[model samples]
Target chain A: MSQAVPSAQRTSLAVPTQVALAGVFAALIAVCSMLPPIPVGGFGVPITLQTFAVMLTGLILGARLGFLSVLLYLVVGLAGLPVFSGFNAGIGVLAGPSAGYLLAFPLAAGLAGALSTVVLRRGQAAAARGAGRMGFGWWALVWLCAMVASFVFIHPMGIAGMMLALDLDLATALGADMVFWPGDVVKNVLATAVAATVIRAFPALALRRF
Target chain B: MNLLDHRPGTSPVHRAPLGVKYAVLLVLTVVLVAWRQPVVVGAVLAGVFGLYLLARLPGEFLAPWRRGWPLLAFAGVARFASGVFGPVPLSPLDALGPALVVMAAVFGALAAARLLVITTPGTELLDGLAHFFGAFRRFGVNPEAAALAVNVMLRTIPWVGAAVRAHAEALASRGLRRGPVRLMGPVLVATVGHARATGEALAARGLPAAPEPKHPGPDYTRGA
Candidate 1:
């Protein structure tokens, strides 16, 4: 486990370990979706920490596991668990306004998770060079990765989903989706902070080599 | 186990093979999304409702709406607005009509999925999924692992909820609970640590994912 160990000595995650981690992380996400809404704005929009959980899963689990976990969560929901926001379930979600966002989540998690792995590996290298571990710079970079995934993947998919499902034009779809931008930004920020703490406590959680 | 409410019965719906039920649901979902005609979606919804009755699963007539209204309302308002305000505006009736049809599609799909769960036992689901995954053996995909992953996900959900509740209570007892963000970090850490422990236990058990992980023993594609 030491850095001095040769690359040949590196341990890859076995199939069972990978599957268990993915499943547990997926359940964590489902629970996050069911967590009580923050009661934001009093209008009953019903915001949950699910978005934060989504981003953090990516940042902490890296690409494959992160993608698998989110995909598992969706499959469970579509198979009839009320694990979606507002406790929605089933394949109908794919044809609804939330379809775009929900479908985009696995991709977004993969993109964010990939970026996080790169950031952590590079950060670990820097730490080995005496820069220390998961510093403020590392946190900011991780946060940037999550934000990039959110902005680049989730919004566009959501808008497209709305346009397709609701028969809306691009302008209208974008307008409707824009309402949640601020909240997404806050969630990404919180996700990075949480992920940073997680990696610090369990360095092997995201990357095996520290 | 109670999460799915799998009512026991010998009805045709219950006796139907899992794959057929799944295929029907999948087909209906795609058709429902593509066809916006209220007449068609309504027919499918009624058919699904009838299946519920036939199965003796008269579980709750209002159950679908209880879980479905929020999603319907959201989609309905958006579809209604889009129709009224689009570049080539729809007539009020046209707008209102398709919007309702789309709502039917959503509800129909949800009900179909619910029906699948109601008639099928959870173990059947796992076996079915494993059988489905068995097709990917050449790609290094372990069928049992996929099934086990889903099984673990089902078991882990409640534990996660309990962990979050415990975290909240502990924070409240110490008066350190501040905002939503505070408990999240600790909950994630605890859950992940638990995952690691579970992974270690699974790895130590090393049961080979069945009679084989890399190689197939018998063709147990006997699907549920």
Candidate 2:
């Protein structure tokens, strides 16, 4: 198992292990979503903190890791793990009204993390290593990348699912889920701020190598 | 194999390969989704429940379903209630049937997964995933890292749950655990810190970008 990389490099979390952790995180999200929540009307979709976990998957795990995590969630759910809102599972849920949203999770996380690598760390890391000026700005890019990812990738798919599943008119679904929009905005901002703050306080949070 | 529910005994269902079990589970789920007929759904549920009994799973193993029942009940009731109060003279019964079936199907799936997880140790499951996804190098992921990540993640589940619980318990012991604003702030701060530390520990040990280890398998791709 040893390689030219230092013990730290050779002993880091392996990719397959990352994939499994993603599944576990997905399960955790499902369990957390099951906790009592701010219920919306007839739809039964509540405002839960699970979305934050999804965001965290991307912000911390990076793009591929984040997507793999969500994928793991889907696989387990498909395998009948009660890892969804309301402790629900099975392929039916994946094809049900909420299926689209579920499908979008990995995308959102991946886009967020991947974009962060580009937007957050790309220029700064190169500069920092050259000039020895690594700072919170790099961390801020990671958060900003996550925010953009959610906006571009996650919410649209969720709204699309709501429209298709509920048979709502696009405009109406958009408006109704506007409630989600505001809350999500808050979640994204909070996630960004929290992520940056964590990285600053613990620079190692940004490190993925062993 | 360690069970999350902590029961013990090896049976065919217990010993089935993760991939085969997953394939069966996927096929059943697809069948359930494709056919919405109550008769079909009921039959499937009945059959799965029969397997459950055959597996000799105790009543305790179904406890997680109890946690979800209230939500299912609420969803069912809310749907019916909307039908009742809505200006449209909607029949509550119409909503009731689909809602119940959906809920039951969901419960069925969870029950099945519970059987799998309870019988399989987390480590063994990760090994299964690594082998299952051993072909991911074509897609740019190092198979070994992917496997390691999966294991790390599974190992952290109990720890994350415990961490969250310990924090909540500490707050409760101090007569706190109120207000989403106040409660989530510390809990989230703690979680992020923990997740980061864990990630860093993995990284410090050369995880994320580590070169793949040698293994006895088909050499599908070059390792870094």
Candidate 1 lDDT, tens digit per residue, B1-224? 55666678899999999889888888887777777676888888888889889888776545767876977877777777778887878888888886777777777777777788777887787677668777888886666777778888888999998998898898999999456668888888898888878788888887235534456567678874
lDDT of 2 by residue, B161-182 (tens): 6766776777788997454445
TM-score to native of every candidate shown: 0.89, 0.65
Candidates in order: C-alpha RMSD to true structure: 4.7, 7.9
Instruction: Write the residue-wise lDDT of candidate 2 on A107-155 in tens digits.
Output: 8888887776554445435555565444557656665776677777767
Badly placed stretches (over 4 Å) of model 1 are A1-10, A41-45, A208-210, B58-61, B91-94, B208-224
Clashing pairs in 1: none
List the lowest-lDDT window of 10 residues for candidate 2 chain A: A1-10
Number of clashes recorded per candidate: 0, 34
Candidate closest to the true structure, highest TM-score = 1
Q: Candidate 2: misplaced stretches above 4 Å?
A: A1-47, A60-62, A68-99, A114-148, A159-179, A202-210, B1-3, B10-12, B58-65, B74-89, B119-123, B158-224
DockQ per model, Cα: 0.60, 0.20
Instruction: Give the lowest summed-lDDT range of ten residues in model 1 chain A.
Output: A1-10
